[model samples]
Target: MDLDKVSFNGQIVDMTEDEDTMAVEAHVRALVLLEDALKKKEWLLLDREIEYEKSQELDPNCPFLHQQLVLNLFHKLQEVQLLKNGDSAGKTYVYPNPDSVNIFLGQSFWESKEYLEQWSRPGTLILAASQILGYRNVAGTLTASDIYAAFETWMNHNGIYKNGIYTCCGEALRDSVCKESSMSHSLLPYMNEFDETDLKKATLDILWDCQKKCLLVEHIEKPQALLAIPEFPIITTSLVQELIEKLKQVKFKCDTRADKIAYTDPRTRNIIYVGNHFWKQKDYLSCGSRLGTIILYVAQLLEHPHLFDGATKDITSETTVEHQGSNSPRSFQEPLNESIHNHDRDPPLPLKNSTPSNIGDALFNKSKSETYGKCKHTADTICAAFEKWMSHKGSYENESYTCCMETARHSVCNKSVMRSCLSELESRLKDFV
Candidate 1:
């Protein structure tokens, strides 16, 4: 066969008939076509069609016919700048780190044989770049501009250009870095602590902050209360307000209906008696009265030691008994012996099955009949409110539940014991219902 000849920069060179020489020539020809296609921004031309074209001119059986071989050959060409020597008058481009370039191009090739096949579609490049940069640590010393420039060059060479592509690329890169940094350092500690819902919320919040503020990953603040154990049946100002409103409703019911109920019945009379004493306290609506005193009364009524342990805060004279450290919920069944009245014959009977309306009527009659009393409407509201509060499902049904829990965890109860106690109190109330 006549010795084959190939042209480089218009210089015709004789090629030997050796198979190795043909392979080298094929490799060189492939590189030439690749560089031309890149310079002209012909992405489609770099696909398998071009490979078949090279195979026609050179030996189809050559080892360098595969795409991987083409990539390896490209890497060698870039390393030696052999192609740049072929163009004395062409502009010299400053290449980024060869490894980054390989990654960028290698990803483009392995992921899709066509250079811009997938990337040419909107947002695909940015999405791929974000995932790669965020999840994988392949962006060594590559700035947003560096990646953008590489992408721009690639696209420009393929005769494709868009106005906001650079900005989008930069944003994607920035977000990826921020996400990786935040997740790895700031949020990592609390990640395991959060349940699925909380984790999702926290992650979305962090991502929002990163994208919206363009914050540095290190600058992203850890979510507040992420590590803190949340208080069950969280108490809130709204919750307290709701409780107070409910109390007012109970008082209204009592004031309007006291005359209708027969006071001779033990259950009916006890409801009125306990309700009467509850409404008599001066601090009936006070935090100590509502949260502490009422909680204590319920514990006393239920005879639950766990409730008493959790609810025993000094709210009124009736709740004078101090909490003795008891492990069992059954240990403290006896009601506190203190009296809300000086002339009391017997402590009012526990209204375990009494309705809120009955308790309200009792409160109204007690307030009307009593001349002097220390703990008045406080106890009444406690009983009435407990009935109403527990009648619904768990505390989660209350609109104020979340806010109260957050408040308890973040502000009101700093100690875990206090939170546990409050939780215990709420649990007992639910069980009582």
Candidate 2:
């Protein structure tokens, strides 16, 4: 539990080095398995045919296969999300962004990188499926109408079978799915009338696909080359130059040029995204996309019918109990102990203890302190710990800075100018204790 020893456990494997060739082999195997499934149109089947018995064991929990699935899905969904909005209807996914500026930039990025490269390999893209939809290669000339008609028929099929699901209130669900769905082939055959939750989940996946695809097109175009594209001709060189500098300041090297196009979510949708760096949104956290994408991802993932039913809720509650019951950090963190013990008896709450004292204590309760001394003590401790956390985050970021090499300007800007910034920051934190 040592905080200072947070470096990755064990020796770091140099991926490019011959010694760590296993990692390379693993990735290749995964991509191969994924391609076999997609080329055969076995997406949902792959979901059902999983390693784990439980459904929750998807996404990150299914680490070995998740990224490849997501990537492949994104590649399949490209035709829908990347094209201009039109009679395309359900044939394409629209960027969730309502803001015109965001849409334009997103479209520019999609056209930048040849998104086709993502799926041109022996297997699916390494890390992008499931979230994207609408990959129909019907006669190499599938129109929007064909896709929508197929989707509508699928909806009716599911509605006929699931008709009993409607109570007086929930019964109205059939009409809902039909309303939101534009037009497309129903990927899920038994889904004639999706409830509100179902539609939301589908929407989330579509939006996630949009963001991933947006990066593909832009990053494909070299920054200089993009300026010459018919649409982005007058893009100020200064802005592009500054953007490049910012990326270097953080040591972010885009393996693919399309990854350079920035994604900005102005929080129009209260969704947030969660995934590995490879599957995550570009510059995910601090980037304009922020919590919205993560929320979107989780919320959508949670939209299945079982998720809303009592069965899933009870399971989640049980899991929470097993993972974070009473024997937790509250046993050691005094303030947290009192807070938990005194909390109103409503839903059972678990405690998290697998954290260092600096962060773990911050979760304690200060609201119930009866005296000024107790209140001040708890307040001070929380404030001090927060300051320490901030310093650590700042130092890590400072150490991350890199310098950009300008071929014309022969000068170093911020190349690993490691001062004692981290050490100095740590020293300041120690005094707080």
Tens digits of per-residue lDDT, candidate 1, 176-269, equal: 1111110111111111223323322332332232223221111102212212333222222332333333322221112221221111111112
lDDT of 2: 0.23
Question: lDDT of all predictions, in order shown?
Answer: 0.25, 0.23
Name the runs in model 1 displaced over 4 angstroms. 1-234, 237-241, 252-276, 284-433
Error of 1 at 9 (Å): 99
Question: Could you tell me the TM-score of candidate 1?
Answer: 0.15
lDDT per residue as tens, model 2, 131-208: 113222222222122222212221111222155543312333222222111111111122123332333343234233
TM-score of each prediction: 0.15, 0.15
